[model samples]
Target: MSAPTEVPHKGLITASLMLATIMQVLDTTIANVALPAMRADLGASSDTINWVLTSYIVAAAIATPLTGWFSERYGRKEVFIASIIGFVAASMLCGIAWSLETMVLFRLAQGVFGAAIVPLSQTFLLDINPREKHGQAMAIWGAGIMVGPIIGPTLGGYLTDTINWRWVFYINVPLGAVALLGCAAYLPHMARRIRRFDFIGFAALAIGVGALQLMLDRGGEVDWFNAAEIWIELGIALSGFWVFVIWILGTEHPFLEPGMFKDRNFVTGLVFIFVIGIILLSSLALLPPMLSGIFQYPIITTGVVMAPRGMGTMITMIAAGKLLRVVDARKLVVTGLLLTAWSLYIMTGFGPQMDSTLIVVSGFVQGLGLGLVFVPLSTVAFATLDPQYRGDATALFSLVRNIGSSIGISIVTLLLTRNTQINHTELVANISLLDPEFAARMSGQLGGLMQSLTLTRGEGAFWSVINQSVNAQAAMISYVDDFKAMMWVTLCAIPLALFLRKPTARPAD
Candidate 1:
């Protein structure tokens, strides 16, 4: 909206922006832990309960690209303030929703209104701060973006356990109010432009993004391509994207400005952010289930163990902010990637018997790595781009990162499910009376137990023990496999850092 220059009340402005950003980002994962409680209260089936999440995700995906156009046409300050008001109102509506249908509708409204807050906040920070402080600015911004999701489940779980699931949504009320006031009072007004909207292009892109999100969110539940619904969604997604690309390339005034792609640093940064999103959110998606299902961790303990990751991220992000002043941004990115890969490699060593120590350690290391990367990546992505395209660029940047997160979570989850089944089958196949080791064990500790009970009871107990052991081992192996796969993904992203050109030095204001 506004050019990068000296601005008054920068501190207040940043605080306001971050509040809104955190409020919006927190909702992304905060509702996850409350799903079960919601399911019971709303009288929803297991299958239908997920619409609470899917509705928000799809609505956000479809609405996000509009941020650029809305900000340009309606003024960034006005749109941002309106988004906060709408989001808070929607949160309240969600909190008080009486049925599944109403909850999904409220959540969709929340997503649509909340979609613009993040990108606009980023644009504001970039606009308010000069180029030299971009790393610091981004570090502040990155902390909220990264740490919000990390703490979301913990907060949600705590609220749900202490009070009820409704508090999860209700909690946003006070925070949103403060943000709304701060923003309305201090956010500078940007002049609106009278540009023509590209309805066709916007429609096509929205369809593509919406369909893609739906496909990803529904695929695992529906057995992926085996379900006709998944196939239809996939086809629609591909077709929508193809048409959008073709339309945008040919249109005089495209929905997104094509020139944004010409910047090497910005383009490269998108690729990196996409990968970061995968690593960040997918690991988060995997950890809770692994902890609760395999380790038998209660919600609070799982939250505590997971808390270190966010702490690590916050610590390094601040450090990286300062580090950017002296170090090469590309070098910092490479180091971050290596550190992330190293953490994932450690995770590959996970076992059913291991304690939380390894999980905490690996998570912290990964957090450090992500923090090191995020600030510099955010700074560099916008460093070489023209201010005119800042709105669209930031929106696109967020969209790509989110899409990456969706795709990543889907892939890892699918792999975990399939691999666990395969591992379970293979492990079961190895068990036989003819195998000497199996027979020895059965005769040793197993023989004593079997002797302690009747024939029918002993046989039942024996098979139950074997099944439980097999299932745990199989699931653990699957978790490790997912970790290994992500490690390779982190490693693969390292070379892309080489393609980033250091931003040319900017003159002092």
Candidate 2:
């Protein structure tokens, strides 16, 4: 293994890298809130407007694996710079897009360019920093990766409500420009290596990832496996993944180097990161709707309520960075997972009539837990791996994390929808005019009002009110169940921390 690269303007390079990373990561969720506005402006149907998001996701998934090959064949600095330019340019195009078709095209271009920014950024940070500083470096990187999604919707909602939805895309222009210039000026140039591009492997992986993303993203909208489209996508995804694995194992020069998996730390890190992705994004996915739909909080208020989670993550990440020097990384991971699970457990107590205090407290604790886990887990994952494979390793790491998030969000959403109906059915089963007890309670509570308004038990108005209450209660219960489910998921990941080996220390430079 080669010595880590020594760069003088490490801070500037890191700033540039983070700007690019935050820019890319923010796009993943930032556009979500803007979808309705985009649909109205672009004259798109409810079903078709989703293509705007789907295009970007599918494009990014297909293009992410190419990061390693691109960085190695072309210089890392060169590819990084180009990606920034392309991403920024695409963002501008997306902002100015005249039609849904144009918007989707621009977003596809944006995803293609932005796909390399994250893994490359991680690779660069790991390269420039010394072994001892890796904890701090990863903390910074993880903050952007984790926090961007947390804040994206909030920022997007503000932009849409205050100005226009286009600003969500336009906001990237300045950030991307700063990142582009900084990277071009301060980022070190890595030596380019000539490697044969594995077209077969690339195609197979692309097909698999793209299909899987489509299935996950589209599943909720189409009601999951009830729709034939999901089944077909699932089959294609499985077949593609199967072929990719088999081909890579047999091929002399695989798209992704198989040797990377042999590193115990790296493999464990992948699993850990996958679980983290699920926990991080799935909770984020569940919160906004719960706050806005059930609590009647406005978009801005929802963002504000959720802000503490990000704050806690940021604070803990800084602390965790320093803690890594004196603490076992594996132990920190266990502690973090426990904290997250505890937070989720708190969330299970949420009710339709409760205040935001519990939400804030639980989010903050989860943030702290996630921060503690992310920095050390990232540092340890790469500690024993060869620097030469960092590009591919980081790309694979990002890909797995994303897939995990998609899966988590989809599963939780599906459950939430199904459970709400089930709960509603069970609740309604007990409420019938035929039952004397139920009739007496209703008459006791509303008999006077019913007489004044000339309303009766059989009236549509009275039943509508009852149905609404039942629906709200059912939805609230479903949300709590989702939280409880997530808590269990977090607990399941706790034992996996034991599998992680502590990284050996290196002498200071």
Candidate 3:
């Protein structure tokens, strides 16, 4: 007798997938704001507590490539269901962890499970949704990816402040339970030809992603190449990544197919997703620190300001879904890119005492642009894909976007650091003048400060005044320089959107 076919209920399956995707993405940043509380409770130092985050990241990164294979062998329903169950169990363990080590381990387990949620869910949605409506299906799914992190930190911040950090993980319990049950009841499991697991590819991918994440997160603190651990991890990451990239291409039975890359529309969609990931992740990484360090907004306030970005995303995605039927896919994507560019351009003008309304507007605009891009790009990738390859394509799309974001975060962090130094150097040079007019101006301010402080008029007073002025100027210029650099990067990404294979209009009935 033939095995029972898994025929997923469309509404139930889609909801389950969406819920799980949101949970996975939210967990990535939801724990971020609660790190302080977690540090104290786990009796761990700041450095040690970082593992809670890193472990999850490494697990997800390593598990990403296996999605295609897992879905192929086990049936998409089984793979997805098992993954969410594992994730829920892990989240529970995380909440109950008595030590930092245990929490880190749990987080790692969560990552392993969480990694499958997005790609598998996408595959499930495609399986259930009608071909003609695939674009709209992607529209809803794409919003989770784009808006998850935006809402995560805010949710985390509120939960941690009002309740305990453990509630954050515990909250996922009920949600995951519902998702798992929903999947079991409604997910349509298609028959799959099982293949032996690619242990070699898996190991290489795991090591590469783990080492690379470590390097990105800790490189700055350890002074980059100067530290032994940093260098060792860097070596492992590069060699592993290079080997995997080469092996995947050279081998016939590699985890991902080389032909997947051959699809012009898919590849083009990937390009947009990759760049969007970079822009979004890098901006998220950079923005909060600036707010706290320069603007001194509390954690909750920071979350409040970031809320507009998510709101914009939700609003734009809903609108984009309706508009999809009217507009060609290519035009939708281009419009998204242009809007994102404009949003970044506005951010370049931020300064001390900038209006609060303007900052929120800028964030909202950024979200709107991202919403438009993410949905269209996601749908574009699958427009011509066969059902057999949907799992592989979805996984490939996710992995590439993540790689882009990682590279983006690393590059932007390095850029900001580099630009800060340059600005600092130039600012100092301008202040150290020997000109008569400059000296006179300096002397006037110097005397006023000295008189107020009741300091003696001499070399000491002049030096003190100059030093204070230079420090203030350097700080102001550093922020200005960083914004300008980000603006240029986003603007430069604009023309590259043209390179993507434009989506075509469907024929009339």
Candidate 4:
């Protein structure tokens, strides 16, 4: 592989690629807010409907490692254009899906086509831009990648509310078409190589990623290790990973090149992004439900309140891009981690009756942290690596981040469910006939109400209100615990930044 040939329409190329990047990243979180609507429309059960998301996630993870090989065998322009077309077609199919099964299948197809977009987009942007401007380029790129997840729910909610859940998928059509045209017109046809396909490595990696994703996605639903299916998935994930490790170490041409990982900065960046993925995406996953369920906000209102988060990230990313010229990248990462941890800590203190201001403020702060970290981290990660490795390295980077996000979402969701149950039981156990404190509390709050309804102590109506209150409180506590856990995770990322070496200054122009 040689250095990227210059394209005359760099601006058009960048815009087109960013459009595709945003379109793809938006799908990651956009479907979440519409899940209820989908369940109702498709007449699917809670457990089964989630395959709409799970299928896409698993398919994308399995196919991501193919980017390098695809780009190598076929030129980058060919693969990218085909991906856009395929993804657009899949989105249309998803929009028109008549059943849950069809929806899952369409989503899986979308994932497979969309997997190459991000890594290829990153690689293309890096290739077009001068080394000195990598920070600025990554900032622009990072804004699309990072802010899409933040904006996804709000956009999904608005579309779902105004039109229908199908519009969530339909929205991709026009965007994808425009991107495809721009890419076709502006992106250069890079040279291709006749690289040998590493089938064994790919199969092993695919099995490992596919199994791990399934385990993470379904573990909570089936009670983790207690279920035979969960145990089987776990065993498969471990076995696949073990095989992949051994195969990669020995294979001459592995699915991923071995030398890519040998770069210290690149390796450390992987760990950094993984932890960042866990905290960043997991918080986004937790917020909407908390707003709708705990605070009782409408879907549109939840989206509106969350808008500030993306704004914060957008503002800081541009600033971080400029600051990279004057500041140490490692310091920026550390600062970002502190801000994220601080926001999470604030979240842990949220009261059940708190106003939306807290949500907005903490979200904004977290967004700022994410922007500061993502721009510099991306710029610095590949600063020292060979240009030829960019395709593979970027793919692996995206894969690790996705895996971390999957694991993080699953962990918090599981903890929230289990902790709610534990807290509910404890609260219920203390609400007995002998406890005067419980009696006084219940009587004071619902005395007149119960009297109006002719309800006696320990009656269904009386206990029903009490139980609802207990459940709400328990869920709030569970949410707070999740926040605390995320804060610690953010704090833990601080040490990893120490391992990253600040790139030396480029020569004076």
- Highest TM-score against the true fold, candidate: 1
What is the clash tally of candidate 3? Answer: 4
lDDT: worst 10-residue window of model 4: 450-459
Model 4 scores a C-alpha lDDT of 0.90
Off by over 4 Å in 3: 1-9, 249-252, 421-476, 502-509
Best by lDDT: 1
Candidate 4 runs further than 4 Å off:
1-6, 455-459, 505-509
By lDDT, rank the candidates, best first: 1, 2, 4, 3
Which residue pairs overlap in candidate 4's backbone?
none
lDDT of each: 0.92, 0.91, 0.78, 0.90
Error of 2 at 280 (Å): 3.3
Residue 342 deviation, candidate 1, in Å?
0.7
| Local accuracy of candidate 1 as per-residue lDDT tens digits, 1-509 | 45646787899999999999999999999999999999999999999999999999999999999999999998999999999999999999999999999999999999999999999999999888888888999999999999999889889999999999999999999999999999988888887887789999999999999999999999999999999999899889999999999999999999999988888889998988898888766998999999999999999999899888998899989999899989999999989889889999999998889899999999999999989899899999999898888889999999999999999999999999999999999999989888898899879997777666546585678678778889999999999999999988888888888888888853232
Q: For every model shown, what is its TM-score relative to the native structure?
A: 0.97, 0.96, 0.87, 0.96
How many clashes (backbone N, Cα, C below 3 Å) per candidate? 0, 0, 4, 0
- Per-residue accuracy of model 3 over 278-378 as CA lDDT, tens digit each: 77667787777777766778888888888888888888787777777777766776677677767767777777556567678888888887778777778
